[model samples]
Target: MSGFKTKKISKNPHQNPMQVSKIPSQKTGFSSKNTPENQKETSENILTSADKNKRRARKISGIFLIISVLVFGAIFAIKAVGNMQLSNNDEYKTFRQITDIFGDNSETPKTPEKRGSKNILIAGIGGRGHPGGELTDSLMLANMNYDTKTVTLLSIPRDLYVAYSSNSAGKINALYPMGQKQNEGVNLLAKKVSEITNQPIHHYLIIDFSGFKSIVDALGGVEVNVPKKIYDREYPNNNWGYEIFSLNAGLQTLDGKTALKFARSRHSTSDFDRSSRQQLLLKAIKDKALSLGILTNPAKISELIDSVRNNLSTDLTVGDLVDIGLAFKDMSNTNILMYSYNNECNGICMPGSYLYTPGRDDFGGAWVLLPENATRSRVSRYENMRQFASLVFEFPHLQNAEKSIRIVTNSKNLSQAKNIRKNLEQLGFPIDHQNAIVQTGATIETTNIHKYYDSAIGTGFDDNHILVEALKKIEPSISQSTGTGAKFATGTGQYIEIILGNDAKNYFQFKGISASMTENNNFSESNKK
Candidate 1:
């Protein structure tokens, strides 16, 4: 007790309760002085503290790393499950079987014989649980030209009357259900479509309303520019009732249900407008699917697969689809062309109209459309339809050029010039009737087609020989001028000019070509004597 003095422990509220004053001890033989031994012990203590801190840091880092791995693994598992569900889907299996039966299981996809083009018939139905679900609601021939990397979509009206059987006739939409009765709906429909289009149907895809909605939803909606306001007061609803559906004219994104309504609403507008809207939606979907990387993204691919699983059926194999996607990956909107035939024949149908409605009294009180030139007894005549298809799909260059044409005629041959204009317009020619002039002079004796080439304006016929050959098919006596003739100046801004002469009266006549020029009032009234 006499050898060392001990300090008391601090109990003050301001001081740390755990702090205690050190007492000098002689029995333990430890020194507070900074001796070499004490210094070594202090250094060891500091080193031990640093090691504990590093160990704690490592443990925390390890926990975070594990969590990250687990999260990524879960995502991968979900994606795998989605893909597995798609691969094992019953519809996908059926599709594969159907393609195998059709002999479309080759490594390379099949294409049409002409220009390496491929045509696929896309049919949309109402599907199960809906009235007339088996009947095709929409029919379109999608033609892809490999050489030009262009796509042409020709919409066939569902109300078109066609001979489904040798002894029976009905609307084209009914052909699908009729074939389904014989377990050959897809093939039968494709055959009929091929006949109508005059293009080989290399493949076919049939989807129902449910499938369409699902696919559109899975793609996160599509962007479309509605050209006009659509206000359908009698749109069909899910409960067999009518509902008002309206969309303002503008660019907007539409979901699955809204898009279906937009495409299917025909009560307010004509079927032709509905067909155009459908085509517009299709292009929008294509652009979204291709441009948004939906093909490469795992999550999106899984979603799309699940969406189309039981809802979609197609003869295209997985490899074939992949090949198509790759081939069309770089295509722009400019490369795709869309056409539809509608009968607005009140006074006269609009230019390029190929289908006309024969009064319901003719077909058992069922309203239907036949070829513009077709009679009730001859419903199978698709010459005009085929010619239009050829002009669109075969001669895309002419359509792409979008060259303006003018028909010049004297008073004597005015009617003949108008007739020729109708024929050319129906064949998809860009006839500039607004600027057409009627030369009030003596009738010329010869019909001449002058090509006005102006390098400065790029307003000339690049495919002169091809066009001449095509026109010759329409009029065998049509002569092509060797140069931009002095009589027809190039300053008219018209790419091609057909100066009608008295000889033009001998031009070939296309049946069902109405002589009514009332729709072109601007051209008619302006050129009136």
Candidate 2:
């Protein structure tokens, strides 16, 4: 049987959007003279022309509609694929785990009760292909207070001796490696740090050396103001060899590699100084990243994620990071308080001198820093260290005030003046001992705290009232007065002068507030001479 066949017709003259269809005209066949038949033919031609115009319009509209649909479909598909890739990628998975993105409700990010402050333990380690790759090279506790809009970075020395196990003791840096034996390095380290600081550690971020370099490089570079020239004769290289590293003293931009060396070099300078430099680098990186708008730029963020994908580890989730960024969006360098422990003070111990190096014989021939007033049996009970941390975290405003303090006294009250300085220093007050003046005249009867600058004129002194109130709490007898006293000259900038009179002897003599034995012995010896 024969089947009926149907012919297909093309409605569109041109299949491409860019192509145009030509209209035919017959000038030779059509006559200009008016006639009944010619008029009918001309009218028919006009109708045909209008019909073609309508078809062209429809064709163009159809082409545009098709193009828009395809374009939108492709865009949505790309987005879907990107999301899938992120979900499947190892970096994204790690980030999710760190942030607890889809984890159980009970294991969510922790928020502290005290003023919504969050304490994060930041540790830097040398990753694989480097010597002692598992050990932490840098450790810092970053405390963020949303209420006060302040941040405190407390650097923990790697050589700090702490008990990692019930029967074993080692440097705090070793805790990371030891914890990794059971796959709980981050938690173990955070727990140990919490014990020392006496504050709960909310999260942890452990990035390797390579990750640090990649992050800095991704930010283009960081601008750091090197206070003094750095010349390291024994900067470690990748192949277990030492190389010379030096930087000029001034404002300079550092790349990733140079910044790593700048932060890691400790052979020429002490470890405490290195810790300070690390803090400086951190601030520089933060300033640069914020100024560049890394948070909002997708391309830059992608680059950063790629850079640290294999090298970074953290317990901070994407949400937590976003919250942190929003919280510190307007933070300045002044809002950050940087502190570390050291034994560099000459006479009496101060904030930076809260740690002292015990004999190497006590630590298996290893030089380690023990908290001042801490015995070997009670290394974890770093009372002085904890107190220092408390002062920084609690009275951040006082530390942020950065007021220079001068201790003025007569010969009869010199000992009391020194004692007050020690106490204030331990409490994290900025003391201006270099510019102090000592008068050997009659002892005044009343102690007064004098303010040299007008309280309303300065930028950071809005919180001066807090400082005054705290001092009153410490010593209720301390009278507050403004204007520079007669004995001490007005300093170049804003400062507080504590004029120690006979009544100053009773200041800071309360229980649990005793001066160091060194200060006591020095005062007694001077009195005899």
Candidate 3:
């Protein structure tokens, strides 16, 4: 396609209550109390012209009210996106003292006695001189709507492809690091997102890792299940991190440090898995803080407020936040909206199918639409923010176990599926599904092994199409199956699955050939075709 198209949804601005009422000010030449009891004697000395003018003035005032009412017709709906409205007066203090994003003296959100669904983006940064490690470990787009007495918390995967909504044409997280210089990263990300989701970001709550830890500690702690041990010998150290979070596969309470690990660890599983863990922790903290009646207890409330104020940065006032928070105090888990970028891209493509890719020339040539998870509507808006939504998928049946993989080009000799498969199996995966398949063209699968493995993790994910670039390097000798590539369902839910696409099963081997990348690292797609 020459250019991507976006879908737009507009909201009408809310009309002012007083505007509709249109009450006009009233004052005549004299007040009724001041009117003379002897009207006949007073009329003899009065200027008839002046009296006539006073009567006309009253008529003009009435006309002014009528004009005000007429002007009310021009009023519009007020739409505030990503604005955080506090549930209680106390919660307001937590926001003001804890956040710094609004600057030393900036206009922060004011409190309105009544509240509505206000959206907020929570960014977890590694602050101080170490902010260089400003990898946003957790990104939450929380929507609190008092109208429905519900809250929706959308957790975005750190690695999902999102347009920085700027000159940066790639991932959304890059907006932060790129922002270090422009000083516009976070805001830019918010703005771009506003353009993308059609929701304006009201306030940004950026927390340093320590502050995050403090908040968790204040909440008593959070609990999570350790899927695998993450040991990064070279992991950053000294307050930053290097220590591995080792835990058996079970539920356990996590202190600040452990909670940090729970949010940041990606060791062996995918970033998708890490996101799930953080979401679980967020819920745990919210539950502990609200259900335990932490706010209701004076001493405990005081301590939490202290901890929260100590760690958070924002532009919201204490009173405004307090009232907003109180409004939301009655809300439960289901009342929340959880928006996932992954879920947005799910089921957008067909499985086992290969789509055209933007060869190196496209960045210099035509805009190519690659097959992957993503909604066309979302892609369009993000594209305006200068980001490509192209996704690559590769899934080949493992054809050989001994050679590990056999080679092949399409009958057209356009791909290298076999070589890559061997590399992946050597990396160690039970990649029999790819090896056993014989077909090469597009197809769909009913029972997917990938979904089975994904569900095993409790994330319950599935994909319809395979990633092409990640696969082409693999050997075609892998068995081909009667399955399509990764296909995630929209709104309902989204997930990446391929029965171990010959490509992903082999990601470890490629990592070596390439270089080691952390959770925040993004693989380069610049080396087109």
- The models' CA-based lDDT, in order, is 0.62, 0.63, 0.41
Q: What TM-score do all the candidates reach, one by one?
A: 0.72, 0.67, 0.45
lDDT of 3 by residue, 17-44 (tens): 1111121222111121234565765663
lDDT of 2 at 28: 13
Ranking by TM-score: 1, 2, 3
**Which has the better TM-score: candidate 1, or candidate 3?**
1
Cα shift from native, residue 95, model 2 (Å): 14
lDDT of candidate 1 over 1-529, digit per residue (tens):
1111112323321111111122121111111122355465663345455457754654443343334335654333333232232222222232211121122223265556434677778888776565456667788988788767888888888888765443345567766655544445466677666666556666777777888998888888999999999888877665556789999999989999998888888887888788889989988999989877754554565466556645656655444554576677898888888877777544333534877777765554555788765765556666677667766776655544444566778888877767777777667665555554445575578888776565566655644545655666556667767444335433545456677777776664654212111212111112322
Stretches off by above 4 angstroms in model 2 are: 1-115, 165-167, 347-351, 397-413, 435-463, 469-506, 509-529
* Candidate 3 C-alpha error for residue 235, in Å: 5.2
- Evaluated against the true structure, the overall lDDT of model 1 is 0.62
